[model samples]
Target: MARTRTLLTAGAFALVTALLPTITTVGAAAADRDGPGPVAVSESRGQLTVTVPPGHGGPGYRLLIDEKTLGVRTVRAGRTVLATNPAGGFAFGDQHATSVTTWSYAAGTLRIAAASTAPADTVAVAITPTADRYDLTWSVAGAPAGARTVSYQLSSAGHWYGGGETSEGAAQPYPLDAGQVSEPDFSPASYLMMEPYWYTSSSVGNYVRTASPMDVQINKSASGLGDFTIKSTDSYASTVFVESTPSAVYQDYVEVVGKPSKSDATPAEIAQPLWNSWAQFYTAIDQNKVLDWAGKLHAAGLGGHTIQLDDKWESNYGNLTFDPKTFPNPKAMSDQIHSMGYHFGLWTTLWINLDSANYAYAKDHGYLLAAAADSTKPCTVTWWNGTAGIIDLGKPAARDWYTGNLHQLMSTYGVDGFKFDTRFFDDSCAPAAGVQAGDYQRLGAEMADGFDLQGAGVRVHWGNQKYGFVIRAVDAGTSFPELRTTLRRSMAISTDGYPFVETDMIGGSLGEPAPTKQVLVRWAQAASLMPLMYSSTSPLGVVDHTTGKPVTYDPETVQLYKNAIARHGRLSDYLQAQARKSVADGTPIIRPVFFDFAADQRFYTTDDEWMLGPSVLAAPVLSDSPTRTIDLPAGAWFDTVTHRVITGPRTLSAYPAPLGVTPAFVRLGAPGAATAIAALSHQS
Candidate 1:
């Protein structure tokens, strides 16, 4: 009988726990983690230490960053015990131990290679020290002749998160016990993206780099052991990177990975706000409304040069043509918009509608994944609309057609770029033709890269978070509850090392009823301090319940909105320069305060506020309260509004945050920045 590959149940994995793996708390008084064995520990200059146990599946590896224990984890529990019958000429005569045959530490490098019988050789693990992190590599002697799956897992203490869109930006507790995957997986409960990156309260970032697809399991053991598995179908080697960069998580990952930049954009374009039509008009939006709004926006002092024309303009998802009924003259419409000092962009996706004309054309042209064509059948993805045939990016010509259409929109109709939106598990739809998910991802990136404009905004999970494009937060609503979530989501994206990020807006995305006047002002106030301030909600769209008419912003509210944009415009050049540096070091322009103030324990708990670039720290009022309390790290800082120099290493009393202003302070830590507000004013 031929052996089949299946996910080993958590129950099956827990059985190995009986081996009594040795675990050390690293922190004082670790009880359950201690097992029978001597731990071989190694420390690096980067303040990271790793421990190896003497017994089989001993606590596995206990990791510590800055003397703070990240908990002990094991990687040996998932090693498959093969039961194939070699009698059918399927197995080699001799057998080798599937476990590590030898382990050694030399000159800051740890080599732990496994010896397996015949074709079942496990990867050789190598951990080398870098300036700031340990570069981990897992490789075989050469390319394997057959497909294989390998997994590396670990368990940590306290709270954990950082799995891109999968973790949903919320820190979740690992189950203290084990069980089967019982619930209908919703909101991407486990792994997200082809990239498997995660972080813990310990301030460590784990970057998984492999050509293979990844499966992440949290709380696989009832005892809360989280596991990350990489299944490589055709590769000979795979690598997963983990490092303790407690000082700066964003800078650490980008430095190890590649730094990304928008090559063609100017500094102004880099920091400019985006005006979106989604909330204002949805499918009802037309060229007239866009042009009319441009005038109104200018009158209201919110005119921006870039505009993103979101969904519903296209007749069909993948048709890639402007709806003739709604947009009769796209070229002229685009020209008029450009004349209004705006570069137009369209919202699009690779989703080919089954009933649309493009579907028939693509189906006939072999531009989709098919079954008889190897198990690589095309899958249907359902979203807010209905099901649609996914355009097979795994195929080159198919990708060409996809990009070609978008280019046509740019060259012919004056459409400058795209907001590439895709929220789904792409690996599930990968063709059986033996291509890795990265193939499709690279193709999508190719399409986005080929766009002439600098603002090719993409939601994560499609590919690695690269520089050339902007990263936007997933759609969020205007309610206080969802508002909090949206803010946290953006924080996660920043700390995850996405430099240029955009929150949906003050009043949220389309289909949302306008937020109350307070929410609108506060949201806008918060957004203005982010990397990019964008809005889909109009100034006067929020309805007044009693009058049944759009509520107009008071003069003060309008000035506040205009003041925020005007201020950002003046500082755009300086902001963009700081943003440009992230490509080399992976630093975040709009990041959590922990990046610079890691010593302050309060930063980890304060998720609602963020730092704009390296200069100002902003805390937006989340409630209807007139003032909100904030913890200021040890530093000399001045309120941006008042330029009042305040020394702080303590919590500030309820700070005043009126309806129109977001509380922000500029750091004056250096002698050159002694008058921080003055220094900032001069630069802007």
Candidate 2:
């Protein structure tokens, strides 16, 4: 029998529906009227099953209209252990679980009881079903002594996209599924981003609602479907959102997290490119060097609005002042940067080197974290820079003092904002702080509220959406493969909800071997299509290390590079508009193509191509090949280069993308179609 009790809690779900004003349906399911409606529930011997229509069809579940599977689910519970150290290392002990003892469904919720060993006598789970999603919570009657691992079994098959940043070198073939992710082998490093949310191509999304260090693993069964095992240190609740399309699932998540806060970056900031000192000069940057780079950037007709001084700008790590030796007359440098029509951004971290002049004062004042071993002494941790004392941002006084120092620096030196840099967890000193790494990161970021803040070495959380600053890709090397890696990194991070995305420098960081002319031009073309195109290596000055001479692009390559920036400039308004919409809802400005075409499996593996808002699709060449194939999801696509409208589901094989051109298509009837098409036409 089917029960039709609505899942809208008097206050909780009512708020969710109000936030999600627009609900799009996928496949053949009946269009959801208003917000989500009641879900179907049925019970069997000792077990209960709830069904919500999936966005797409699958073989293992009950069929719905258009052959779509009604996603079925059952919950289970287990136990595990979490250990962390000062070196930002974490380990999880072996895990064990118990089967469901009994289950009952009533008033839109399914409750399951389970038996556990000592420390935890019993475990109870309550799953409340809504229109196309469910909220699951678990609790123990007795202390588990360790962590609890909750899991859900879904009879669906598809690739997984979210769940934080992709591990380094694991970028291609899109989704992290089956063979790509496994238990024990797939460790917390994969979850370093600490974003415990994942949405799949099958239109199922899982969000582990806990800040505690947790491990999320997805593995395919022999039958092709998969299991989501989320182990957290504390008993917690998680939500499972099902929709007809991945985009709807993402929107549902955004509603829960709330829209981007007003403090997010301004429209002008979103539209302009950022130039950083790290990629070009690294720690060797000086006052004169910055000015020279700014002049060179201007001469190239690249009006980058922000020039960031990355690592080594500070007199010492966490000192929050310019190094006098490298940046003599810091105030004058800031004024010159501002006079040149740019925002001066300084890099910062919480690590205060013991050698720093202010270290003793901070330690004496209770601003520094105490060593875990000796509460009387300040903690010392070694990092790339050196061993340093970390500021205890968890303390309100410490945060206020830190904020005041930055404000003083900015006011005295004409600094417009800061690029906050620090590992998500850095406790080389084994600090005895009670604050989790994620909390500390959020607190540190909050101190930069209202400033032109950007995150480099930080974690991405849904709550931080309000900060509205750009989150950049990790450093990239100067290789064609690395260029592709940069693209995958952006797509992964963007889909994880850092909407205002920025790529590293044009030709990769200067730390690696210089890119050849071809690689540099190709990288420039690809980065131009992202939300923010960052450049550091001077287009006119980068030396070709292989030849020991300036990397000189031919007329075609040069034109292609210039054309990329021109196209980006022309579409700036469209990008800004999409960014605003993302703030209003929870959608990303630059996202995987699957977000729109989830029913089409062909796009599930797409990593190189991306959708810039709804109107434009960019297919930048990411390899050394002179030509590449292009796959267009169902749509009326207007090819920018040929000026022809090609209807697809169609595949354009061996698309002629010469040295100086990238393939981009503008959807004919999307909201910003006219503006995007016009931009492409102007570029062509």
Off by over 4 Å in 1: 1-161, 166-195, 201-203, 211-225, 229-245, 248-250, 261-265, 371-377, 423-425, 432-434, 452-456, 460-466, 542-552, 669-684
Cα-based lDDT for every prediction: 0.55, 0.64
Q: Give per-residue CA lDDT, model 1, range 394-474, as digits (tens).
A: 677887887888878788987877777764234455452566555555556666666644343665442355644566666
Clashes of each: 11, 6
Candidate 1 global lDDT: 0.55
Query: Where's the lowest-lDDT run of ten residues in candidate 1?
Result: 81-90
Off by over 4 Å in 2: 1-41, 45-47, 51-95, 115-122, 139-143, 150-155, 168-173, 178-192, 218-234, 371-376, 423-438, 454-462, 543-559
Query: With candidate 1 superimposed using the best TM-score fit, by how many Å does residue 145's alpha carbon deviate from the native?
Result: 15
Candidate 2 residue pairs in clash (backbone atoms < 3 Å): 55-244, 86-427, 261-466, 264-468, 265-468, 380-429
Model 2 has a clash total of 6
Write candidate 2's Cα lDDT for 1-684 as tens digits: 223223344464447545754232221222322234334544332223444433332111221110011112322111101011111111113333344444455555666665443334555667665555667676666554455554333223356667655454444334666344433322222223435677776666777676545544444343232334334344667777656678877887777766566425565555566777776776766888888888767766766678888888878877787788988898887888888888888887777888888787798899887775776887777867888887787777887787788889888988888776665334333433576544755675576564567323243453566666577776778888788777776776677677877666788873676777778788878876777777777666655444445554455655566677777778888887888787777679888887877667788777778899998899978887889999999989999888999999998999988767778999989999999887777554
